[model samples]
Target: MRRYAEVKTANMLMAVELSRRSKGQLRSYSLHPGMVATNTVDKEALWPAFRQLDIVTSDMKPKENGFERWKTIPQGATTTVVAAFDPRLDDKAGTYLVDGNIAMKEQVASHAVDPVCCLLLE
Candidate 1:
């Protein structure tokens, strides 16, 4: 899990670097898919790990949590679909998308975009 998170952060940083180097000729993005139910999400295997955290929702959407209704695999693709085709996002390259829109300012990590911290990745 630690490695997973580190790799995700690295990928986000790389997307920013790639976009910057391309100088408007290309674009890149990062996203959070939230939780999606699929074959890959083996409840049996994950149950033990999640049991420790105690926030695991049942195998149902809208499970007790008021904010999110867990999405099906197809439903989970909406953000990607929008990111790929949405004209509104054309000006928003190298940004993080959540729920089919650019995440708000506070939604982004302050240190993630810092050039000083980015140097450590090299």
Candidate 2:
């Protein structure tokens, strides 16, 4: 999932750049909808692919705690809906959201919002 993280970082960087360059003409955001139970992934193929990478999933089972549970489709769509229409975000362009809310500073990586890192990506 390293590649996935890389792509997510890039996506947020683009949002920042676009929002800055366009000023008030544009608003952009990046968000992580919580892990949702989707049928899009082919479950049978995922295990073998993980095996090929020597990934040990024995200890990677789903968390049964109050957190880390998968959401249904509707539940997972909450963030997207909020990002698109929430008046509370009127002044919060280029933000990264998690679980339908603005992510706390501690939740984001420093480099993910750094202009130097954005330039390095070019």
Candidate 3:
């Protein structure tokens, strides 16, 4: 997934550059949705393992194993929807966002968006 994100970031940067060369006619952004609680993951598999990890959960909540906590699907979509439609982002093209804010801890992703990486990606 880390490698996938790195490559995806490079591609996004390339698109942003292309958009920029289009003379302000296009927009692009990279958005990260936090861990979301969805039904796609096999809850049955996670349930048995949670007990070993000392994770206690009630049956009412879905177990999303990879992260400390899970956001509802709508909650996870906040950043993506914002990136897609927010007028405030008119000047924020090529920005990498997480949770509807700039992502500051994304060293690998930042490097992927660098000019050299963008060129290679081209």
What TM-score would every model get versus the actual structure?
A: 0.77, 0.79, 0.67
Q: Candidate 1: how large is its RMSD?
A: 3.0
Global lDDT of each model? 0.69, 0.76, 0.66
lDDT score of residue 48 within candidate 3 = 53
Order of the predicted models by TM-score, top scorer first = 2, 1, 3
- Relative to the unseen true structure, what is the C-alpha lDDT of residue 61 in candidate 2, on a scale of 0 to 100? 35
Error of 2 at 105 (Å): 1.2
What are the C-alpha RMSDs, in order, of all predicted structures? 3.0, 4.1, 4.8
Q: Which residues of candidate 2, in runs, are more than 4 Å off?
A: 48-67, 120-122
* Pairs in clash, predicted candidate 1: none
Error of 3 at 74 (Å): 0.6
State residue 15's C-alpha deviation in candidate 3, in Å: 4.4
Of 1 and 2, the candidate ranking higher by lDDT: 2
Candidate 3 lDDT over 21-48, as tens digits, reads: 6666677777678667676344675665
Q: After superposition, how far is residue 2 of candidate 3 from its true place, in Å?
A: 4.5
Query: Number of the top candidate by TM-score?
Result: 2
Alpha-carbon error at 120 in model 3, in Å? Answer: 1.7
